[model samples]
Target: MFTRHHALRAVIVTGLATGAGLLLAPTASSVPVPDRSAEHALAALVSGPPAAADLALPRDFGRRFGYRPTLTQGLLGDPSGSCSSPVPLPAEFTAACRQHDLGYDLLRYAGRSGRALPPDARRSVDTQLGAAFEDACSSREEPLSLASCLAWADIAEGFVRVNSARQDHAVPESETVRSIAPGVGLGLAAAGGVVLAVPALRRRVGGVR
Candidate 1:
């Protein structure tokens, strides 16, 4: 029989176990690599004096005239690409994901072409993605939906930040996509077991009362 003290202990244990599960949970998957040809095409398009001209176009210019065909093509190739996260993000996140992909593509292209961008450049891009996620989440109309969206946004941002931390900015992104180590999986499983036990403990405490 569970006493009040035992019930409180179970609650505390459940909280710790849940925290461990979260800490050990594997990060989101790696970003998908665009094709080499697509990368080169995008790189060439963004290079040269005309690139400056392209940027000078209004933000809405691409929406009107297909001004940024490379971006369109890239998004077309991977429409649902939410930074390779398996999480089901809100529809509003698509634009942010597209922009994030463009940023990463630029970094990858630069690295492959031997004109590697500074490490801070990648950090800036990742930061921008996080902000974009917040913006997207804030746009939700309903309060509960907004809160849920924000939570998912945090998860997505956390995944990318962890991924960015592991990356070697000096090299292309292709070299950085790696599977999580076995130890993390074990910890996650242990935490899950503890969390699963909470309901049984709660039932025992309720019966005693």
Candidate 2:
């Protein structure tokens, strides 16, 4: 008795919310400081999801670090300059090294400006290296050193925040994206409901639900 009642109530709540949300969702050309090119591009994707080639273009921060795939995931969740860092990640131990080796070559590009390392920064790197080495060593629960090195690199010290010469935007471009997302989300949810409410669509809805 309680199970059916709850499910019915939930469906009612979901449908009403979905309908109202879609009806009240934002519309085009409402943006105040409209960058039409960006707006058009986003609208195209919202109307239709991006093609694979569209996703192939690099984000600005990712360009800074070149082609490190996990740099952003390593550093931040962003998949940009964070983890798949331009700085070479430390290599895992091999049969020859005996001990775990940090065969990093990424720092070769650092300090092209000839700027001196501040004392604190120098200390931080030294401390991080020590911690990283220790982490990479014992973490190898396996009989081999290679396993430990892999575990530690997941949290190794790969961070350096550089100030970009370009000016930062005062307002977020995401603000516009945010405004558009709600409408698109409501539309999708309503479409999903229409699909779900049909008995013929039950199997597909089961997978989605």
Candidate 3:
């Protein structure tokens, strides 16, 4: 009986060892990974000029606003199309200008931080601007004037979004890595759980003495 029990134990141990060897074996995907540093360096070298231009927000700000008439309307001139005179702007138009400036400043800060607006924050800003635009455009006082102001704000916000870190071509590697690590970690954890369960199989066999 003792010899039989010993033989059974040896078979079980050998099976478990084989199973572990298979589990730990290097699959096709486990082959040596290629060095991406060279590729990344080459890409950065090629993209240097364009990346610099995109980051130069303040320098391009004037030209961009100048080309967009709606953006300059309330900013450079009053409701009566007077640019030189210092007259008080209509309330809605003033608010529009404020919002546009706010958005522009916020975008500059984000650019400096090397980050993009989160979805919730972006959606909130869009919704708020949309609501304000509708209110101002429908107002009885200087409706056309206020409409121009809201249009300016919308254009500024659009520019910010386009130049932001959300652009696929310019997105940081850190962001992509952050998005993928969690799923990979979960897969590894599941595999580890299976490996851990293997040790418990010996307790279930009725032949062990």
The TM-score leader among the candidates is 1
> Which stretches of candidate 2 lie above 4 Å from their native place?
1-65, 68-110, 113-116, 142-209
C-alpha root-mean-square deviation, candidate 1? 24.8
What is the number of backbone collisions in each predicted candidate, taken in the order shown? 0, 10, 0
> How accurate locally is residue 3 in candidate 2, as Cα lDDT from 0 to 100?
100
Q: Rate the local accuracy (lDDT) of all candidates.
A: 0.54, 0.32, 0.40
Better of 1 and 3 by TM-score: 1
Which 10-residue window of candidate 3 scores lowest in summed lDDT? Answer: 76-85
Instruction: For residues 1-209, write the lDDT of model 1, one tens digit per residue.
Output: 88999999999999999999977876553333333443443434333233442343335434533325234322221233444554345677776777666666556655655556666666766777788778776666655566556655656666666667766543435532235443344334534454455444434334221
Candidate topping lDDT:
1
The digit string of per-residue lDDT tens for model 2 on 68-181 reads: 322211111112212222223344312111110111111111222132222333333334444444444544443333332433332232221111111121211123555445
If both were scored by lDDT, which would come out higher, candidate 2 or candidate 3? 3
Q: Write the per-residue lDDT of candidate 3 for residues 42-119, one digit (tens) a residue.
A: 222223332332333344343434422122322221122221102223355454444434333334334444443343
Worst 10 residues of 1 by lDDT: 69-78
TM-score-sorted candidate list, best first? 1, 3, 2
